[model samples]
Target: MVFLPSLPAHMQRRAPSRRLGVWLWALALCLCLFGEGAPAWAADGEGDITLSSRYWIDASGVQSVDEVAAQPAGTLVEMDGFRSFSLGSSALWMRLDLPRLDPSQRWFLLLSAAAFTNEVDLYQRGADGGWIRQRAGDHLPVAQWDHPDQTPVFAIDAKVQGPVWLRVMNSPTPTSPRLQLLTENSLQTKRYWTFLMVGGYLGFGLLVLFLGWVHARLYGDRAFVAYCFYVAFMLGFQAAFTGIGGLFFWDQSARWNDMAPAVFMLWLTASGIWFVREVCAVSRHHRGVDRFVIAWSVFGLLYPLLYVNLQTPAAFAVLNLYGLLSVLLSVALCLWTWRLGEAYSGWLVLGFLPVHLGYPFPALRSAGVLPDSWAMQYAVLIGSAIEIPLLLYILHRRAKDFNENRARLRALESTDPLTGLTIPLVLTLRLRDALRRSRRYGHRCGMVLVELANHAEIVDREGREAGDRALVVAASRLSAVVRDVDTVCRVSDTRFAMLIEGPQRPEQLKLLAQHVVARGLERVPTLPVELTLRFRLVSATLPESGDSSEAANDDERLMERLHRALDRLASEPRRVVLHLPVRMPAGA
Candidate 1:
C-alpha cells in the first residue's frame, strides 16, 4: 500500500473542501477567543504571557525543591494557554533589554511565568553588579515542596521601571534546568472587561445567597437550610480563590486558598448528595442503588488531594474524565429512578446535563485544548445557575411528598381501625411533642382524661358491630368540636385523652373541657343514646426559662404529676373531677 497524506482519488479531490471547513473552524475559534472582554495582546519579540508558579525540578536532578537555594538566581517565564508543557524546564528565557518605559504612560507589565523553580523572588540588578531586593511586592510566598499544577500564569499589574531581574530558585535536585519566556501583550484596554466579569460573578453570587435566604423563609422548609449552607461554602471558597479574601480580609494567609478549595468541594458534594437523596426518597426504593450513587460521590470527594498534589495537565485530564464518568453515572441513576416514576428524579436528570458539560470546560481550557474566555467562564456559571432551579424544584416536590406521607402515616397510626377514633399510641406521641414545645417556649398546654361510662356493659348488650359504631360516632363528634391543635385519643378501651393549648389557668382548662364534653353529648342525640362520660381537666404552666431540653424534662414531670392529680380527682363518688393547676418546680 502506498502512503498518502490525503485520501486517494475522491478523498484527495475533497481536500480543498476539508481545508475550507478547517479554516471556518479556526475562524470561529478566533471569534470566540478575541470577541469581547479580552485584551488584544500581540506577541512582540519580547516574551511575556500567562504565568503561575509551582516547585520546579532543581539542582541535583531530583524533584526536591530545596536545591533551588544553591543555584544562581534566575527568572521564571511562561506563555499563554496556547503554549504547552508547563511542567518541564523552559526551552529558553528571552530577556527584554528595553530602556524603562515612561512609568506614567498607563502601561501594564505582562510577565509570563512558564514555571517557577521552588520559589521565585524579584530583585534589581544594581549598578554595582549586586542583586538588591526590588521591594515591588511581587514575590509570591513559597509553597510546600508538594505543589499543585497550575498553568504558567501571566500576572498583570502596572508597569514598574527599574533594572529588575526575577530570581528563580529551584529545588536542590531539579531534573531539568531551564526557564521560558513568551511575548507580552499590552492589557490597557482589557482592564475594564476584567473588572466587569469579576464584579458580575461576585454580585451574582451575593444575590443568589440573598434570594435563597428569602425563599427559605417563605417556604419554611428545612432543605432550604441545607441549601443555604452549601451555597455559603461555595461562595466563600470562590471569593477566597479570587484573592478577594486576601485583599479584603487577610493578606498573609495564602494557606486558606491552598486548603479551602478542597474542603469546600467535599462539603458541597456531600451536601448536594444528601439533598438529592432526600428529594428522591432514594432510601424508599432500591436502597442498594441509592447507596451506590452515594458511594460514587466519594471519587470527587477524594480527588481533591490528588488534584492538589498533582497539578499537571495529565492530572487535570484524568480528573475531567473522572468527573464526567460520575456525572454520567448519576444521570443514569436519575433516569432509572424517573422511569420508575419517582417525582424528584426528573429534576436530577435535568440538572445533570449542565453540570456534566460545564465542569470539564475549565479543565479543557486549562489544558490549552479549549479557548479560554469570559464567555467560557460564564458558561460554567450559567450552568450552575441552571442547577439551582432544578434543586429548588426537587425540594418543592420533596416537601409535597413529605406532607402527603405525613398525613397518611398519621391516619394509619392514630385512627382506630373500626371506630375511626384517635388511637392511644398516636395521640400520646403528638401530646408529648406539644408538651415539649410548650415547656420550651413558655406556651400553655392542658390535658383532659375522658372515660366512657359503662363501655363494657354497652358492648355486651349491643353486638360488637353496634359497639364499634357507637365509638366511631363519638370520635366524629369529638373531632368536630375540638380545634385542630387539640388532639383526641382513645388511651384505652374505655379511657380517652384530649390535649389542648390555651391560656395556662385551671379555670380556663376546666371550662374548655366542660364545653367540649357538653357539645359532644348534645351531638349524641337525646332519644335512644344514653352515652354518659366523665372527664378530668389538668392544667400546668410551662417554665419561662425556655430551655427545650430542660422543658422536655419538665413536661415528663408534669405528666407524672397530672396522673397523680387524676388519681385524687377520681376519689369523688358521683361525677368526674376537674383537677386545678398545681404549681411545681418553677425553674423546670
Candidate 2:
C-alpha cells in the first residue's frame, strides 16, 4: 500500500465557502475607494440656484417662441422635477421664470441631460426687447453651441427678464431634461470634475482594450479577439451616450451625431454577447442556448438599420428590451457553462457581477421607469471600469491554463509512461536532427543502445512486478550516467536508446559505453540481493550523409545497424559492449 503524506494545517484546502472571501473583500475595498462622489458645487450649494419652471408640449413640433408665449396660462403645466418624454415628432417648451440677480455676476443655465436632447433652442430677450435665439444639442455641432461644452449651456440674462423660453426636440430615444441653473464659478468647477471623471474612465478603458488586443495576438485566442471588439464598442457606446463623441468626434456630422448612441448601443450589446459566447464556449455544451444567443446577437447587430430608418418609439422600446435580454442571457450562459465544469466561466461570472448589478439602473432609466440620477448616469461606468480589467485578467489566466495543458499533453505523448524517458518516436525524431547537424557541421555524434539481457530471466524467477522495478532502476541508472545534453529513451520492453550529441572521439564513446554497462550491472535495492542485472550496450558513431537521399534515411539506417549489433552481442556470451566502427560515405 502507498502511504501519502498529510498536508500541513496551513497548506490544507479550505472549505468552498472560504475560497472566495478574499476576492470579495478586495472587491468591496475597490468599490469603497472608487465610489462616486456628488459634484462639489452641487454639494456646497453655493454655485447653483433652483428656479421654478413650467412646460408646454407642442404636438405639431412647429411652434415658434412667439406662438408658445401666446398660449393660455392653463395650457402650461408646472414641473415638480425633471420629466422624461417618449420619442416622437413633438417638441417640449419650457418657461423658466428668472430671479433677480446682480447684473455684474454672470450666470448660466446648465442642462445636465443635454446629451439626450436632439435640438435645444433658447430664446432670450435682448436689451433692445427683441428675442435673441441660441441653438445647442446633438443636431448642432458642439463648437456652434451658444456655450460650447460637453452638455448644452446657455447664458442667463439677468437684465431682460420676464421669462426665458427653451424648446427641446428629442431624437429616437427618450428625452429627460434635467436643468440646473449655475453661477459661472460653479459651472467651471462642474466642467473640471466632469472632464476628470470622464477622461479617466476613457483612458482606463483604452488601456484595457489595448491589453486585450495584445493578448489576442499573443495567444491567437478567439475569445480575446471577441473581448477586444466588445471593449471597443462598449467605449463607443459610452462616449456617444455621454456626449463625449459629439463634443470631440463626429461633431460636424449631424446625421451621425444623432444616430451614434443608438447604433453603438446595439453593436455593443451584440459584441458583448459574442464575447460571452466565445469565453464560455457555450456551443460546445448547450447547443440550443448557443443557437439562441447567436440569433439574438445577430438581431441586435441588424436591428439598428431598421431603427435608424423607422425612428419610432416601438423601435426604441425594442432596443431597451433587447438590452435587458442580453444581460440576462449573458449571466445565464456564464452560470450554465460554470456548472458544466468550465472554470473560466466562473471567473467570467465574477468579473461581470458588477456590470450585472449596475445594468438595471440604466435599463430602468431607458424604459422611463427610473428618473434620471447619478446612479443612472455613472453606475454602468463604474461597473465597467471594474469589469473590463477583471475580464482581461480572466482571459489571461485561461490562456495560460490552455497552454500548460497543451504542453502536458505533448509531454505525455512524447515521454514513456513507466520510465519517464522519451518514447521511440521522440528518439527517432531527435536522432534524425542529430544526423542532419552532424552532416552539415561535420561533427561526430554517437548512439548507445542498451538492452536488459536478463529481463525475461528476471521476470521468470522474480515475477513480473520485479521485472518492472528492474526496468525502472535500469532507466534511472542510465539517465544518471549520461550528460544533460544526451537523451535517454525507452525504445522497447527491455531495450533503451541514448543519443549523445557532440564533436566526440572514439575514446569518449568507449568510456561512456563502459559507464552505461557498469551502472546497469549495479544492484537495485527493490530486487533480491542475489540477483544482478545483465546489460548489453552497443555504441556507434553516426556516419555523415553523402547525398540528400542518404540523409533522408540516415536515422533509420543507424537504428537498424545498432539493433543488428545488439543481436550480434547476444551471440557472444562473454562480451558486454560492442563498439561499431564509423563508416564514411563514398564522396566524404
Candidate 3:
C-alpha cells in the first residue's frame, strides 16, 4: 500500500501509544473513503470500460442498501479478474468508475449473465450527489426490461460519468458475473455475433442428428435411435437451460424462461439413461441392471410432469440431485460394461464422462460455490459434441462388422466347407423353387447329376485328402464353365449336382453335358496319382424323374433319382452315360 508521509521526528517520538492509535484511526478512515473498491474512486478511466475488471465484493447476505453501506470498509474485498464472486443467498456490491465523457458520447452497460441472475440493481450518481436506481431481471415482465433483447442492457448517461454501484442479488447461486461497457453501435454488433453463435451451434447439432436418424432408417438399430433421442434431449436442455431459447425463441415467455431448464433436464436425464442402455447393449448383456435402467428412465420421463408446477428451492435441489445421481449411475454402467469386455464400451465411457464430470462445474459456478469460467461452462458441450461423431462412427463400424459376420455364418451353414459347393439344404431349396417356376411358366429346368465314377477308387488309392482336393478342383472347374443362372452343389462326398435352367432344347442339353464332361477332364483327379478323377455327366429334365414311393417332397424325389442314376453309373463300365446314352472314350 502507498502510505502517507511519515510524521515529524518530534511528533513521532512523543506519546507512542497515543500516536499509534491516531495513526490507526487515520488509516481506517483512508481505507473506508479511498480503498481500491471504494465507490468514491472511479474503477475505470478513459475510452471503454469492462466493468468486471474492477469490483468490490461483499458476500454479506444484507439486502438493504443502507445496511450494506454501514458495514466497515475492511469487510469488502477487491475482485482480481472477473466480477465473479460466489456468495450463497446473498448480494454482491460492485462499483465501476468511468472517466469523464463528453456530452456528445453515450454508453451502454451490457449484462450477459442473465440466465444465472434473477435480479440486478444499477445505481448511478446524479448531479445532486445521490444514487439513482434502476431495476432489471428475468423475473420482471418483458415490458419492464431495460433493453429489447434476451440479455439486459442498461443505458448510461455518459455526461454524468463518475462512479456507479450495482447491487447484484437474489441469484440461484453466487457467481462472478460478466459485464461489458460499449457504445450503442458496439452493443448491436455483440448481439449480432451472439445470434450467429447460437444459430451455428443449433445448426451443427441438427445436421448430426439428421445423420443419426438416417442410420436408424437404414439399419433399424436401437443404438442409433437412442442416439437421436439423446442428442435431441441434450440440445433441448442446452437451449432452454442456457437461456438461448429465451433470447432467440421465447424471450417474451416469462414462465417458460423460468421452468424450461428443469423441464427439459427431466427429459435429458431419461434420454441419456436410455441411450446408455441401447448403446451399451445393456438389455442383452446385463439383465439385472437393465431392469433398473429401464425403470429409472421411464420414471424420469414422467417425474417432471408430476412436479410440473413445483418450483421451490427444495424442488430445484431435488432435480439437481437426481441429475447428478443419474450421471453417476450412467458412469458406473459404462465402467461395468467396459470391464465386462464390451470393446465399444470404451467409446461409451469416454463419450459420457464429460457430462458426468462436468455437471458439478455448472452447479458450483451457478451456486457461487465456484467462479464461472469458460472451461466449466462449456465442458459438457465440447465433450458431447466430440462424442457424437466418434460414437456414430463406432456404431457404423459395429453394424458393418455385424452384417459381415452374419453373412459368414449363413455361408457356413449352406456351403460344403471342403469343396466350397452349395450343400444339400441350399440345393434342395433351389430345386424346389425351380420346379415351382417350371410348372407355372411351363419352362424346361434340367437337373444334371454328374457322378465321379472312380472317386472311391481314387480316395482309397491316393488317400482321402487328395480325393477331397480333386473334388474341390472339380467343383471349381464345373462352376466356372456354367452360366451364372445355374446352381451347383455336392449332394454326396463323391457326387455333385447342377441345376441348369434356360432356353436349352434336348440337343442343346446334349451339348451342355458334353461341355461338362470336357471341363471335368480339364484338371486330372488326385487319384490319377497324376489324379484319376473321371465322371459321366448325365442330364435329366425336372419332373421327369418324379416317380417316387416314400419321398414326401419334390426335392427328395430329385435326390432319390440322382442317387439311383449314380448307382447305375457305378455299375457301368464308365464308358457311356445312361440318361444321355452317349460314350466318352475309345480306350474304355
Candidate 4:
C-alpha cells in the first residue's frame, strides 16, 4: 500500500451530508493512489504526455546504468510531483514507465531546464534484454547531441517496453527538472514558435545596435558609444542564455559553450552600468554616486575572471547578487540625477523601468529562490525588447538638442542679438576676403553704407521701442533686397553696411542703392503712419588690379573711407545717394 501526503484543510472539512462527503473522500484517495500511478502511453498521442508523478532517487554522485538498475525497488522514492535540486556535483536518477507506441510515429522526451544540467544520459531496454544508452546536454557540443536543440531532447524508441532510466548531472546553477513527452508533430510546432520569437528578438536587437553605433559615430558622443556596447552585450547574453549561441554561433567549442552564458551576463551588466553613467551625466552632478558606479562596473567586469576559475555554487550566487545590486543602483542613479534636473535622466528612468521590473524573476531563479516558470524563461527578453529601442530614441533626442544648443551659442557670438544681422567683426572678416578676391581675380565688389537719418527723431516722437522696431524693419528690408552671397551688418547704432560680391557695372550699384532707399521710405506699420524712415546712402566699388589706392587691400581703411563719404553725404540734405570713385581716399 502506498501512503500519500495529507490533503488540504478545505478538502478535509466536514460536509453537510456526512455519507456523501465520505464517498467523495474515498474516490479522491483512490484516484491519487491508483489512477495517477498508471504508466503513461505514447501511442497515438496528439499532444504532450503528462508524467508529473514518477519515481526518482538521489544517486549522490556518478553512477553507471548497470549500478542504477541493480538497486532494489525499496531504494526508489515515489515523487507525486516535479522536483527542484540545489546546484552541486550530485546526480539524480528518474524512472519513467512508457507503454508501447505506434511504430509509424516518432517521439521525444524534453528536459525543460536543459541549461542548468551539464549532462543527461538516458537508458532503455533493448530487444536482446540489454540496456541501450543515449546522451544529450550542455557537456557536449550541441551538434553532437542525440537531438540538437536549445534544451536537452532525447528520441524515444517505439519498440522498447518497460521502464526507462534517466540520469541528470547538475551544474553550478539551480535546477528544476520538468519532463514532457512529445510526438514529432507536436515537437515541430513547439520548435517553430520558439525559433520565430527568439529570431525576431535577435534581429531587432541587431538593428538597434547598428543605429546606436551610427549615432556614436555621427555625434561623437560617449553616451551613444556606451549604449552600443551595452546593446551588443545584451544580444550576446540573450543568445547564450537561450542556448542559441550553442546551437548556432559556437556549437563546436565545448569550453566556450559552457562559459558563454556567465561571461556574457557579466559583461552585459558592466556595460549597462557604464551606459547609465554616461547618458545621465552623473559625474557632473554627484561625485560620490559616480565613483561608486564606476567601481561597481569595474568589479562586474573583473568578477567573471574569478567565476570562470572557480565555477562553484558560491560563485554563481555572487553573480546573481551582483546583478540584483546593479539593477537597484541603476534605478537609484536615474532618480537622483533626474531630481537634480538632468534632461536625459528622466528619459533614462522611463527607458529602464521595463527591464527593472522583469529582472527579479531571473535573478531569484538563478539564486535558487524561485521555481522554473514562464517569467523566469522570457520575462527579461520581453522587457528588453521594449527597452532597447526606447533608450535609442532618448539618445537620439539628446544628440539633437545638443546640436541645436551649440548652433545657438555660435550665432550669439557672430551675429547681433536684436537685429539678427552679422556684427562689425564678422563683417570685417568677410570684407577682407572680398577685397582679396577683387585684387586677385580682377572683379569689382562694392560696399553700401546706409545711415538711418531719422532714427533719433523717431525715438523722440515714439519712444525707444519705436526706434528699435524701425531698425529691425530696416535690417529686414536690407536683407530681402540683396543676393544670398552678400553680407549685411549692423555696424553702429544708426548705421548699416552691405558687402556685395560682383563683376558689376556702375549701373547695378546705382540700382541697388535706389532699391535700398526705396524700401527704407515705405510706410511704417509698427510706427505712426505719418512717420517714415529716411536714409543717406553712399556706394563705392572696391579697387581691382591696376588701381593705385593704398586701401585696396586694407579692409579697415576701405571701411573708413566709406564712412567719410557717408558723412559728407549726410551734410548735403538735398542728396539721397553718392558714389565714391575707387581711386579716391576718404579726404582726397
Candidate 5:
C-alpha cells in the first residue's frame, strides 16, 4: 500500500491555529453552559410602569386575547373562533397601554407574559404613536417586542423623546384570549451575564468548526467535521438574535443580522439529515427524500440574502417555516435510522429534540402571537451544544470498527495466508505494472514455474499439513533468492510462478533455477522432498509479428507444452536437453 505524498500547496495552506481554535471554542461552550442568567432589562427612558392583562374575544369564548394578539392582523383576515362578544374577525386584539403626556423623557417598556388565550400581539407605542420596532442592528430580523428575551421589551428609538404609549393588542377572532404584560425593567444586570454566556457560545461554536476541519485533514473522516459546522451556525444564530453580535462585533451586524436564523437553521437541518443518512444508509430506501431536504436547505440558505429588502418580521416568518420543514425532515430521518437499527439514532434524536421543540417559537413570536424575544430561540442552540459532540464520539467508535473490517478484507485479498506470498490477483497486477516499466525502459524479464514432483506421495506418507508446510518452505526459499521487484505466487495447488525483472543472462537464470530447486529439496533433510522446480524463461520482448495479447496467450500455451515435456523428462528419473526456435537465448 503506497501512499502518495502531499502536494506543496496543501502543506503551505495548513492552518496554524486550527487545534487551538477548537480548544478555545470548547472552553467558551463550557462557560456558557454553566453561566448565570441573561442581562437585566433597562428602559432608555425613566417613567411610570403599568401592568395589565388582555383578552381575545369574538362571537364565542374559544380564542384568547393572547392568541389573537400573536397573529398579524393581515393573516387573521378571516379567522373564526369562540368569543364572549361578537368581535367577528378571525382573531381578537387587545393592549395594555402606559398612557401619559410628557415630551422631555425617554422610557423603556419591559413585560413578562404568562400565557395566551390563543396567541397575541404585544407592542410598545412610541411618542410618535408608531410601534417601536425591535431591531438588533443588522444581524437579526426587525422584531417589535422582547421576543429575544422570552419576555417583552420595547426599545424606543432615540428620537421617541417624550411620553409614549405601551399597547398590546389582539385581532378580533371568535375565541376570547388572555395574556399578561408583567415587568418594567427586565433588561438589568442579568443582561451582562446573558451577553457573556451567549457570546461565548457563539465564539466556541465557530472554534469547533475550525478544529473539525483540522481533524478531518489529519484523520480522513468528515462526518464529525460536518456536524461541527452545524453547531457553529446554531451558536451564531443565538448570538445574533440575543444582540451579543451587535454589542461586540457591531461591524458584523449587517452580515449576521438577516443571515443568523436562516443560515443557522438551514445548515443545521441539512447537516443533521446528512449525518443521519450516512449512519443509517437512508439513501438506499428514500433517496429522493434526501435530495428534497438538500434542495430545500439550499433554498432556505439563500432566502435571507435574496430577500434582504423585505421586512424582518416577514423574512423571519419565511425562515421559520423553512426551519419547521427542516425539523420535520429531521424527525423523519430519525425514524428511518431508528428502524434501520442505527446505533447513532438514539443520540441523534435526543440531540435534535430541543431544536424541534424550539422550532415553533420563531413563527409564533413573529406573528405577534407569542409575546417573547428572539433570544428564546437559542434554546435550540443550547441543546445542540450539548448533543453534537457526544453523538460524534459515538459515530467515531462505529467508524473505527467499520474501517477495521475494510482493512481486513483488503489484507485477505492481497496476501496468501498459507504460504505468506502474494495471491494471484495481487501478483498479476504487480506483474502487469512491472512489465510496463520493463518494456518502457528496455529491460529484460523472466518467469520460473516450480512444481512439486509426486506431491501425492508426500500426502500419503505424512499428512496434507506436512505437504502444505513443504510448499510454504519452498516458497520462502524462492522469495529469499528473488529481487525486491520480483514476485512469487501459488498459481496452482501443485505449481508456483515467480516473476523476475531486469537484465539477466541464460547462464545467470540457469544458476538461479538450480539454486532454488536445491533449496526446496533441502527443506526435508531426513527424506527426499521429491520436489522439482521447472524453469520456463520468457523475455519481455516478444516477436513483433504476433499480436501483443495473442502472443501472450500463445506464450502461456507454449509454457504448458514445455511443462509437459519436462514431466516426460523427469519421468525417466534424469534431466534432458530441450532446444528452442531460431530466437537467440539470453547471453547467446
Candidate 6:
C-alpha cells in the first residue's frame, strides 16, 4: 500500500467539493467557539482584575511560596484557566501579581469550580510581609468552611505589595481551573444568580411532580405514573450530581453524601427506561428494543451497589461513562420507536433530545474529556429544567390519548356494528343503572322490547337478506319514534329494545307503543318477493310490571317480564301490529 494521499478515479472531480466542505466545517466551528455566551474579560478597573492574563502556573507543584517568589519574574510562563493541565497527586500553585489600587477598591478571589475539590489553600502577604493563609474545599464540612454556600472564594487584602499564592491539590484529571477577581457587587450578583438557578431547578421538578400526580389520579394512565417516577428520580439524581444533595441534603451523613449520586443515577435510569416503555408501548411496536431497555434498567439498578464500594477516580469515570451510555441507548430507543410510527412519538423525540444531548457534557467533564466550565457543570440541570414544560405538554397529550383510547375500546366492546346500538352486556348495565337512578331520584323509567311479526315468514318465503332489510327498516322507525332520552338497540335479528325515561301513565305508555308499531309497519323495506311485513311492540314500565324488591334489583327478572309480554303477544299472530298493555305479575 502506498502511503500517499490520493482519491479514487471516480472521485477526482470531488476534490474541490471536499475542500469546500472542510472550509465550511471550519467556519461553523469558529462560530460555535466565538458565538457562545461566555462573560467578557474584565480589566483592572472594569469590574475587578480578571487574573486571566496575570497568572503563571508552576507545573512541578513542588515549590514553596518563598522559593517560587525567589525566581525571576521572567522564568514563569503565563497561562489562563483554559490552558491548565492534569497535575496528578501534585498540587498546582498559581501566582497572581496584584497592583495597589485606591482604598475604595475591594477585590475577591473567586474559584468557580465544582465543590468536589479536596483541598484549596490561599496564601496572601500580610502587613508585615508574612504569609497569611486561608483554607477552603470539601475536605472540611460546610459549617467549617471559610465560605460555606459557594465554591472557594477568598477575600484578598490589597495591602500586599507582592503576589497572591494559591495551591489546589485535587483529582488527577485535566481540569481547566476557573479563577476570577470580582468586585463586591459582581460577587453578590454571581451568588444571586446561582441561588436563583438552583431554586428554579428545584421548583420546576416539584411542579412537574405535582402536576403529574394530579393527572395520574384523574386519568389513571400508566404513562403518567411512569412520568411521576421519572421526574422524582431525575430530581434526586440532579440534586446529587450537582452537589446540592451533599451540601444541603446529607451534610450530616458522609456515606450518604458519597453514595447518593450513584444511587440516584441508578434509579433515574431505571425509571427512565420504564417511562419510555410506557409512553411508546415499546413491546407492542418493537419488542427487541423493549427487551434491551429492560436489560439496561436491570443493570443500572444493580450497578450502584458496586459504586458504593469503589470510590476511586477510575471507578468515578466508569460510572459517569455508564450514565452517558444510558442516555445514548435511550436516544436510540426513542429514534427506533419514532421510526416504527408509534403514537405520541413526536412528544418523546422532541422533549428528550435536548436533555439527552446535554447529559454528555457533564459526563465528559466528569471523565476529564472536557474542561470545567458553567456549561459543563450546570447545563444538564438547565436543559432538564426546560424539559419539564415540554414533558408536561407531552404528559397532557398522553393522558388525553389514553382516555380517548379507553373510551373507544369500551365502545367497540359494547356496541353493535349493524345498528350502532348498545349490545347485551352494556344495555343490561344501563338498565341496572337506570333502575337505581329511578329509585334514588324518584323518577320513572320504562323499557319496550319489540319483536317483529311475520319476520320469520318473510325469511322463509324470500331470504334472510329480506328479513334483515325489514329489521333494519323497523329499527330505523323505532329509533325515530323514541325521544332523545330513550335508547334504542337491536337485541336479535327480529327484536329491538328501547329504554324510555318518562313519568307517563300506563295509557300513555300504550299510546307511545302504538305509535312505534304503526310507524314501523308503514315503512317495511321491499324484498324480491311481493309481501307485507309486520312488527309488534310490547313494553314494561318499572313499578307497573312487578313491585317486589327482587324485580327492582334483579336484571334477570326485568328482562324475563319483557320476554313474557312478547311471548303473550306472539300467540296472537293474527293481529297485524300488536301493542300490549302493562300487566302486573302474580306476586305484585
Best by TM-score: 4
lDDT scores for all predictions?
A: 0.50, 0.79, 0.66, 0.79, 0.50, 0.68
lDDT of 6 by residue, 1-588 (tens): 101133345434533444434543553453365333333444354333333334445657676778866778786657643544555667667776766644576777777554446567788888887888888665555455565554777887765667787777665344556676766676777777666777788887998899999998998888888889889988887776666665677655545654665688778877887788888778997678778878877777887887667656776666676677776666666666755665455447557755765677666665566766667766667667767667778779777877898888888787776666778777787778877876666656778888877788888987988777777777677888878877788877778888877564566677787887677546344864356546676776664433545445466776777777788877776753444444445455
* Model 6, position 254: C-alpha lDDT score: 47
Clashes, model 6? 0
Ranking by TM-score: 4, 2, 3, 6, 5, 1
Cα lDDT of model 1 overall? 0.50
lDDT of 6: 0.68
Backbone clashes under 3 angstroms, per model? 35, 0, 11, 0, 77, 0
lDDT of 2 by residue, 1-588 (tens): 111133234323522224334544654565455433334445232332223688888999998999999889999998876557774789989898877756776778777655567899989889898889988988887877878877888998776768899898885667777677677887888778667888899999999899999998888899999899889998988888777888888778777778887899899899999999999998999789889889988998999899989977788888888888888788878877866767677667667776776778777777767666666776777778777887898899899999898888888988888888999888888888887777778777888999999999889998999999899988998899888988999988999998998777778999998888777667778877777778898998766334434533367767887898899889998999988864535433
User: lDDT score, residue 302, model 6?
Assistant: 85
1-588: candidate 4 lDDT, tens digit per residue: 111223334433621235434533553453344332112333354333334335445546767778877889887776654446673777778887775677688888877655566888888888899988888777888889878888888888887778888888777886766676778876777677668988999999999999999998999899998899899998898888777888889888767778888898899999999999998898998788789889999998999899989998889889988898888788777767766767567667667766776677777776677766545766677778878987998899889999889888999999998899999999999988887777677788888999999999999999999999999998999999999999999999989999988776678999999999899889989888889889888888877446645555677777888898888888889998998865645344
Clashes of 2: 0
- The estimated TM-scores of all candidates read 0.47, 0.81, 0.74, 0.85, 0.49, 0.73
Deviation in Å, model 2, residue 16 alpha carbon: 12
| Alpha-carbon lDDT of model 2 | 0.79
In model 2, the runs with Cα more than 4 Å from the true position are: 1-38, 42-51, 70-76, 286-289, 410-420, 429-444, 451-485, 513-536, 541-588
Task: Give a tens-digit lDDT track for model 1, residues 82-197.
Answer: 33333333322222233444433433333222122233433434457544442111123212212111211222122543333343432111212222232222443343444455
> Model 4: how far is 315 from its true place, Å?
1.4
Span of 10 residues, lowest total lDDT, candidate 5: 172-181
The deviation in Å at residue 574 for candidate 3 is 4.6
RMSD of 4: 12.1
Q: Give residue 584's error in model 2 in angstroms.
A: 12
1 or 3: which has the higher TM-score?
Answer: 3
Which candidate number would show the highest lDDT if scored against the true structure? 2
Is candidate 2 or 6 superior in TM-score?
Answer: 2
Q: For candidate 1, which ten residues in a row score worst on lDDT? A: 144-153
